[model samples]
Target: MEKHLNIPISADEIRDLKVGESVLLSGIMITGRDAVHKWIHDTFIDKTKPATQEDLDTLSQLKPILDGGLIYHCGPVVSGLETKQYRFVAAGPTTSIREEPYQGDVIHFLNLRGVIGKGGMGPKTLKACHDAPAVYFHAIGGAAALIAESVTEVIGVHKLEFGIPEAIWVIKVKDLPVIVTMDSHNASLHTSVRDQSKSILNRLIEG
Candidate 1:
């Protein structure tokens, strides 16, 4: 099925999605990657260290935005950085499997409805999607420049000390195309493909 969705997607809306569905998303989503994921896990989920005032402040700002919202695993190439008029030159997705350790917890903690990235996540994230009633939206990997066209505006950014790539960028998008590769029903296209490939390889070897 093809659907057009807006950010701050409801849990019910996310639950309706299924693997292999195409979607065009509009509205706000925050960009996060490895450093942001690790920080969120360590500071918020695991509680390995006490959150600083800055951390708390950032969380306070993000909580409402992320509640029933999407997080994109993107490290965009940006321009006009010094002027603070940021524009995404290329906003492509990064590998999502690296976030496997933190994604599940992050989804639950943030009340996230979706995760957008390239490639796919693992069993942990799949289980999280089932439990949290979330979904994983797969973005195209090589179409960085093309994807940037969807980013209508840069609302703001946080944790600039993490550098441009790792900072959490809040953006508004229009008609951002994605495919549901993992769904709240515990379906994962990635797992299916992997298993099918393995089966094929085994059959060839046996023959």
Candidate 2:
């Protein structure tokens, strides 16, 4: 099934999604990468150390936007940095598996309804989706420029000290295309593919 979803997607909406379904997402989304994920996990989820005032302030700002919303695993190529007028030049999805260690905790902490990225995540994140009633939306790899066209506005950014690619960029999108690779029911296309490949390899070895 193909569906169009707005930001702050409800738990019900996320639960309705299934693996292999197509989704066109509109409204707000935040870009998060390695640094952002680590920060979120350490500061909010694990509490490995105390959160500084700046960390608390950043969390306060993100909580409202992330609650029941989507997080895109992107490291966008940006322009106009000198003028402080940022624009996404190539907003491509990054390798999501790199975030496996932190994604599950971050999702639960933020009340995220969905995640957008290329290359699906792992079992931990799949379990988190089941618990949180969220879904993982797979964006097309190597279509950075085309995807950027869907971004309607750059709302703002936070934690720029993490560097441009790792900063949390709040953006508004219109009809950003993706596929449901992982869903709230604990279904995962990535797991299916991996298992199928393993089975095929086993058969070949046996024969």
Candidate with the greatest lDDT versus the true structure: 1
Candidate 1 stretches with Cα past 4 Å from truth are none
- Summarize candidate 2's per-residue lDDT along 1-207 as a digit string, tens digits: 569998989988988888999999999889998999998888778899689999999889989999999899998988888987888899979999999999988888889997899899999999999999899999999899999999878889898999999999999999999999999998999999999999999999998
RMSD of 2: 1.2
Model 1: how far residue 57 lies from native, Å? 0.5
Poorest lDDT segment (10 consecutive residues) of candidate 2: 40-49
Worst 10 residues of 1 by lDDT: 1-10
Candidate 2: regions farther than 4 A off: none
Error of 2 at 169 (Å): 0.7
